[model samples]
Target: MDIRVKFLGGAKSVTGSKYLITVNDFHVLIDCGLFQGLKQLRLRNWDDLPVNPEKIDCIVLTHAHIDHSGYIPLLYKNGFGGKVHCTEPTLELADILLTDSAKLQEEEAEFANRKGYSKHNPAKPLYTVRDAIEALNILEAHPFDLTFRIHNQIEVRFFHAGHILGAASIELIIYSSQGIKRMVFSGDLGPMHNPLHFAPVKPPNADVLFMESTYGARRHKDVDLEKELRQLILESDKKGGCILIPAFSVGRTQLVLYYIWKIFQNMKSRPVYIDSPMAISVTHLYKSFSNYHRLESDSEFGHHIFDAPFVHYVTEQSKSKVLNTIKDRAIIISASGMATGGRVLHHLFHRLPREQDIVLFTGFLPEGTRGRDIANGEKLVKIFGEEVMINAKIHVLDGFSAHADQDELVEWSGHISEPPKMTFLIHGEKEQAEVLRERLIGRGWNVTIPDYLETFTLFDHV
Candidate 1:
């Protein structure tokens, strides 16, 4: 018997997570995510999978983030027919995200064609909404902690990773020729104290461990979240200027809303508008899956916290456009957290030049994104082929991040009952992964930092 794993993506980068595991003749792909940020990385989305999509037996999704689960639609569009197993909340959010992804693809293609900026004769979307719906049809939702068999020789269990509402860490056990082997994949561990979600579950003992190193080299700054938020809100309110926050629709958006509800419940507050339709829909799911969050009762707090009077949902495009025309003091939260694409870009185009306005970021911005450029104090940024001056006061609230920090990740990895024979550090930049490798080696753990497309034999016997 022989078993091996290959890194199709997410080796020394923060996006495009894909791993292929082969057990003799059987195959399973885990976390079929889309590449984002840099053009070189994003172009990989159009490249054919290392293995034929049709040959794959199943897809074990980690979560619903674009970088973790975005490529499912494209896979379906090509040729893949198998079960996509995930948490119930992931299924719901994926339905929304994939559809939105398809829409954005089509919109981007159309914009390129109209502006004659694309190299292609006629820009075409990689996949359509129909493809996304087709992908959504194959999703099979499972409850956490239930051991389910994907094939006669393989079994998997989903444990809470706490990065988002339905995020999970996967435990896989395979019966191979050498013997039974255990492998664990830390999908994306959450911080120790998330406001809306629970802390990540400690990983069970395994022969092989695949861990994420997204924040391996850095720790998030400890700041008074409410105080910073209050200061920004009051300053913006005083100037009669709007505060625009570019947040991820799934986890970060809801966290910001929760914080605002807590901070401004008694004081006179500005009307808060959720400008992304997908976020509006996802917030309702947060209520539906109250068991996954830190809330006591879904029914009691759902209306009070999420559906508050001050919170407004802008679902229509015309209504979203109207937000740009407004000059009053309000809090507008939009999507594509990194300002890569979405309504947030348009908000940035409108509000970035306003000295009194504020643009707040509550998430991590990858190195090549416009969000990072602005965060790094780039005075001039490009948006939609137009140069946009960055005059708006820029601020970041790292406390709202979904990924665990370096110390938190080390602490989470310490929970394994016994040290694994081999542990792979993945899902980060090369520098970040190396820093973590050194830290883990100092702790007497055997760690390997794999390169892109590298393969390793996990179990072998003759």
Candidate 2:
């Protein structure tokens, strides 16, 4: 059998992570993520895949991040009818994220049509809620470390990736007529020092490896997170202004809450409002799956970290809208971390023009995202099809990122006892991927950075 690998997405970009592995007539897809960030990349979501979705046999998910698992609904709508395999927590998280994703798209499309700002005459959502529900019905949950068979010649196992609650790096054992080979996919490895997660598990021996390079070009700065958060909060409070945090609902939001809780314990605490409904739901999962993370204990205040008196969960649209009227002494946390879409946009539309308010971002912002533009000090940002002045104090706290940095990535790669025949770096921008490729080469490992839709032969007549 001839084996080949193709990069359908996540080639030289951080978003839309999909990879296709083919062994003769059998086909398996790893990750069916949506393309985000730049307009050109987002347009790819409307384009047809080179291969028919129905032709793909199965899908294996690495995590539940939108960029990693958001495209399943669209694929299901387009004719993909295969089982989606992932860890039990991943399955649960994906259901929430995918449903939210569909709702956002539908809402955006309807708004665009009403406003007549979209180029398309009548904007339409890529997929609907029904599609997402249908796609989710096919998901098959599995536990980490248990070997399972997807095909007669292929066996699969999962290792702790430490990125999120159930994120995992996958190992595939393929048995062919000629011999046996192992292929490993390093799915979004988390930082070694993340408070909520343990360190990523080292990779077992492999003949082929695909690793993530999200932060390959730089290292995370060592800073006192508590001190920085305290200063920001104090400064905002002194100005009699609210601090708006655009954090990812999955990991970053929870981490930010933990740090804020610590800071509140030592000082006067302001009301912290979590404005995203999805984030509120995701936070509750930490309680359900105690073994998945390290936040099982209560805080020094004798309450669950998320159950503090000053912390408020906003669920209703009416309550969320009321928060827009507040102008001082509050910390509002919202979703769509990049400010691509979500309730955060409404908050941004109202607060960006206020010089006293602070808009704080807690993670990586990809190219062409509104969060990146604001963080880059753009004076004006368009919101709701209208130009809005950006007078708010903009800040980015990189220490809160969940992805592993250059040193951590190198350390993770070094855990492999022997170098693979070839290592392809995926899930990073061009410059970052190239930097990682050079670094690995210095360590006596062969590395290649694949471009979008590129294909490479892994074995011949195996």
Candidate 3:
């Protein structure tokens, strides 16, 4: 029994989320995600594939989040013809996200070529949108909570992660001559009371577990996020200020709009503009699978918060410029949540330096992102290759975070069915990971924080 688990990404830093496992000659790559953040992390995507894609037997995804699924187009482009397994909702979301990501890369490359900013003479995209579409055609859908065999010796199953619409925590069982080897990969854990989704299921018993520690170190603020959303919109409208919120296109955007709908339920009038074209379409995709959401059928919430009026879809440069004339009295929710890319950059260029306007951050901003800099109170910043002074009244409501808090993680894992032999923490900063490790150890679990690219043998009886 030779089982080697390699932490390719998402170990120490929170960006790229790749992990590879090998049992004899059978190769399985858990994720082949893009490394996002500063240039150092982003450069990893440009390098050659870590392993020969042809030799990999299968690729299983935990969820559709870009850090976990971004590089699928690149994988397919690099000659990985294997089956990619995920839930049905995850497949739909990935279909939207991967195509959009490839298009964005092409757009970026074109922009770079025009502006002469890129080192490449004619700036080529990492992978084209066609590559993403090709990858999408090969997707294999598997339902949650069902155990299915992949090979003679390996079985794979997924449990609902409750993090987003179709998130999951993966469990793998490999039969060896000595005994059975069980491993669990806990994807991004959702909060206890997520606005639209149900709480995640209990962790299953296993010999090894890979858990995320994104929110390990801190506790979120106790505030009714709905109330806060109402107040923010009212105050900004009264002051004739355009409120800008940079949000992720998928789960975070949907949650924010749900709160927006909550506020509008009481308001008499308002003009809200959802600028990102990707978000508008993704919102529709979200509705197509609305049955997967807990709140879609809830009596207390409207079924179509995404279809609210005053929400204009902005895609082209000309249409986006129309927002400039929008009299500083409307709400604008744009994308590239971390202020990293997308149309949000143009919005921030104007809004950030305006004292009357407001910029609201809703998602987790990693260390090197522009969103983190603004949230942390950096005075002057760069946008679209120009330095701009910070004048917008930046408001960061800590309650808007999407991940589960420290107590939630502990409480959820503490009451699992079977205790794990060893736990490895990933997708967290050092401070957060270390604190969570100590706290988990206090509860009497064998926890190991694996270093980046660390390798560990699963069975001792090899």
By lDDT, the best candidate is: 2
Cα distance off (Å), candidate 3, residue 72:
1.2
lDDT of 3 by residue, 1-462 (tens): 688888888888887898888988888888668888877888888887668888888899988888999988888888888888998888988988888888889988898888788888999988899988988987788988998887799999988888887888899999987778888888888888887777878887778888899988888878888888788877887777889999988778888888887777788646777778778777877667766777654466756566667556777878887786666778888898899888899889888878779899986789888899999999988875679999999988767676888888888787666668778888887788899999999988888888777899876655
On lDDT, the stronger of 1 and 3 is 1
Model 2, residue 439: C-alpha shift (Å): 0.8
Task: Give the range where candidate 2 is weakest over 10 consecutive residues by summed lDDT.
Answer: 294-303
- Return the top candidate by TM-score: 2
lDDT of each: 0.90, 0.92, 0.83
| lDDT-sorted candidate list, best first | 2, 1, 3
TM-score of 3: 0.96
Badly placed stretches (over 4 Å) of model 1 are: 298-303
How close is every model to the real structure, measured as TM-score? 0.98, 0.98, 0.96
Tens-digit per-residue lDDT, 214-303, candidate 2: 998989999899899999998998888999999999988889999999898889888999999999999888778878887656535222
- What is the model-wide C-alpha lDDT for candidate 2? 0.92
What lDDT does candidate 2 reach at residue 165?
86
Which stretches of model 2 miss by more than 4 angstroms? 298-303
User: Higher TM-score: candidate 1 or 3?
Assistant: 1
